[model samples]
Target: MTQPPPPPPNQPPDPQGGFGAPTPQQPEPGYGYPQQQQQQQQPTEPGYGYPQGAPPVPQPPVPPQQPPYGYPTQPQQPQQPQQYGYPAQPQQPQPYGGYQQPQQPPYGYPTQPQQPPYGYPTQPQQPYGGYQQPALTPSAPGGGKLSAQLQIVIAAVVAVAVIIGVGIWYAGSGGDGKDDEAKGTGGTTQGATGGGGNGAGGIGGGGKEKPPANTQAKMAFQVPQPKVPDVTDVSGSWITDKAYVKPGVNSIVAYDLDKGTPLWTLPLTGQVCGASRHVSADNKVPILFEATKRVAPRYYQQCTEIGLVDLNTGKLVWSTSITGGSAGDQKARFSEVTLSGTTVAAGGTDGGAAFDLANGNPRWKPQVNDENCYDMGYGGGAGLVAVRKCGPYSSQYVLVQNLNPTTGAPVSQYKMPTGVKYASVVSTKPLVVAADVGETAGDGSGISDFFSLDEKTGKLKAKITADADQYAARCRSTRVEACSQALVGNGRLYVPTEEHEGSSGEYGDETNEVIAFDLTTGRTVPEKADAGDKYTLVPLRMDGGNLIAYKAPPYDKGGQIVSIDGGTMKSTVLLENPADKSVRDAETSFSLNGAELAYEGGRFFLSETLVSKAREGDDRNYLIVSFAAGH
Candidate 1:
């Protein structure tokens, strides 16, 4: 037998395994079909199973068929084999013009039709003239490996997108975009770990325990006196670093707290009737009412001057003179003046006046009705001036109004309780109105009621009633009658009281007590008095949750400073002032020569006037002392 010849170039090999076997009929042109094989020639050389010079077997001729549409008559050139095996069978042109492998088996074995890979097409594919297949990517078990540079770029893009999203969220959430440290005043600095330190002081009646009392006199300084004679009254405001002194009948001077140096002095051309400190954010000034005596034939006349002097520079900012009859008759001479923000309001029995603080121009004329008398003053922390109008008869109602700080217009107005003749504002933040509630007794003593109003709407919050006899007595000794001896702190009002003696004609038989009332519920706090404590505990102010009180003597003598716990009512002496001969001599000559206590920041201040024995004729000097420990 002879070996088979190789197939013609550009033609496919037979799919059938038999020698010189006829192939099946193919489909017409343009239809998808496998390429046909050409006739093979006999082998010239001998093969392993065949001898030489064997007769050649004739192959049957294939019928002529037209070529597929759009294809040339000649067959295409065969491509190189992808793998080392028998010559590859010609493939049909795919629909996208890519080639597909033939459906044929290896030599000598029965031919079995090929199946496409799973998920691929089983039928023959058609030609698609300009289409190309995408190249397959090399991959591992999971997926293809990415380049290092591409991975870094993807991570950077994702991180940037996250940062942008976070930035947008933070801006929408009320971030002020300022450093936290730059937003505070730094005034109330607290201690490191202690609970009852400066800034650690809580409000609303809840706070930490009081610290141990180590209030020995830490230091002392003197506020120098003006050389003028007849120094009538001296008062101090610890909110500012200055003290006010009224010397003689016409001069008011302000002195520095640290060095006893005079800062400014206001000399009135007329006799000074009354003066007060008007505190504002931009400037602190003294408001004065002065009366100049004008002598006319047979009758004496007088004119009043209302003036404001800058405390820092001693400059007379503004002054206006009003003839006695034009301003408020004789009542204008004694009108109460109060400062709230940039408005200055003066109200009296006759009328009232509101002035702009910037230039002292009149904002509005005083409202005076013949049947009612009005009194105006500061409303404390609510940034308002209270105008209280009382009727002529005690049976009529009293009207109260809280005026706007800048406009002097009534923001809220309400009538006093029945049978109340007078109402005055005591505190402003938790607005407290103090008024005489009922008729006086035979001894001229009465009951005073304190009503706490809502700061914004002036609605009543709480009401507490207290005895007015001791309050009246305490106010009579002070220069300013409107100054509330009752201290408001830690959500309680601490009022000084005295037990009235029976009808036995005994003046020195009264015992003093300080009562604390809760502002929220208007109930008395259940606290016991300090054991064996005889002296009156007069509360001046609150330091944290503790009360800074003065132990007043029964007679006109010296006193000591003490700290009273708000929760326990325990008393601890902070300063001890002996009633020696020198102090008694000073008190005998100068009635105002006693210890005055003030506290600011974290330090305690005490101002005392001592008689100068070296000088003649009632000469006195002032001494200011400070006490600061664990501040």
Candidate 2:
């Protein structure tokens, strides 16, 4: 390759004058020989570099020392180079955008040189629409070897940064593919699972837990409606045929006891169905419900008909539409109703009265001065027991009255202590046991007080308190967990009350519970209904014992059902779901023969199948399980 011509005799070739600034003029070219360029001479003054006569140009800041590249860097001087070998002469000052003619150099150097702007590349002269960017070149250092080392270092740093960034991103992405898969399948790799997974797609995550297997031979009954059911009575296995159904405004339906299926659906005819209360003394008769109906056109209409159905067949044994004088008057109501054998007794709003079972015939009617009488009880042998309250809807005391069931004649009357609100007769032969409400002073907690009465006269014989601490002392020989284990038995009552301090530091108070009471001595003892203890099964009832109780299995925070022994009283862990907090109601009872025990709760039925045989042994315990078909 031919080398480029050298600079002219009077010119210098350095292009490092901070770029973009004007340079001295170029020299003329020679034929066959290298052209020459005229160079501006540096003035002798300090911090100045320019020829004797030239246009002024701005210079860079005063550097600490002269830069290594020998180039003009002065700002104030106006010096210009003369033609080669020629004497200095005055010349016209050039305008900012004007160019001067080239002058010949005295000796060896190229002419017509150009300088580039600071941090910019020089461009070839071409006709174009706009500026074209120069190709980018890698930056180089002062020395060749050092520049190569710097390049190597930068490449390494960049590589390392990219690697680190990728690693951080991967870590922050959370679960791996396998983890996600596991979550999708409810934390398992099982096939076709539906629900939130353990990681991302858990099978049971968002899906509801699988219900327990239903294995009972007898099918369990369902509420006629899936909403809050109006529970009337537990009369002989929950028969739900239409005959037993009370027409409700919402088309209410009850369930059948044997098949656990919905019974008859009665068109409520736009009236709210009432709930049944309890079973009669014979255990075969059920005291069903009665409510008034409000017909349309007028805002209110008096209800006259009372329905009495056979427990077994749901057959309408009797229905009586009572007639009160006025249409809007509510006093034409059948306030309370009950049954004895084939006879149905009803208390009317006008006065106390009883009706016949075979037909809507009045058996007897009695006079009651008080208008707002609420509840009535009966003793065997055709005598009436009523609870009468006084004051503006405030029940201060309970009035116990006995009337002739056949004639509805007043027999006798007695008043209980203050604050006696609710009462139920436990027996009615020679002696009668009744439950009444009482409240203590400390927490004003209400207690169920049991009382024994003389059947011959309407008189209170004895009162018993179901003190928890007292029952706990009696059961000290055995494992005692809670005070509520006491239960009432034939002609006797059992109850347990505990004195516990309030968790809020308001002073520990006892829960005075009344499970049962003894009529003869007026003493209360804890029976087995109190299963609130941590985990200790207390037998709720024994065979042939009037009182029976059972505890449902303990579950985790979640309400997954599980099987638990009624007698074990031991706590076991079941499904735990912290999100749901619902109160569970459990009822335990002995089989009709008392050979086995059963428990009922929300969609759960538990039974001790071998309890009768087991009770013969010292163990007296049997496996408890959820009833498969009956639940």
Candidate closest to the true structure, highest lDDT: 1
Q: What's the lDDT of the predicted structure labeled candidate 1?
A: 0.41
Against the true structure, candidate 1 reaches a TM-score of 0.52
lDDT, candidate 1, 237-265, per-residue tens: 32354553332335555555554455666
Report the error of model 1 at residue 121, Å: 99
In terms of lDDT, the poorest run of 10 residues in model 2 is 179-188
The TM-score between candidate 2 and the true structure equals 0.41
* TM-scores of the models, in the order given: 0.52, 0.41
User: What is the Cα-based lDDT of residue 332 in candidate 1?
Assistant: 45
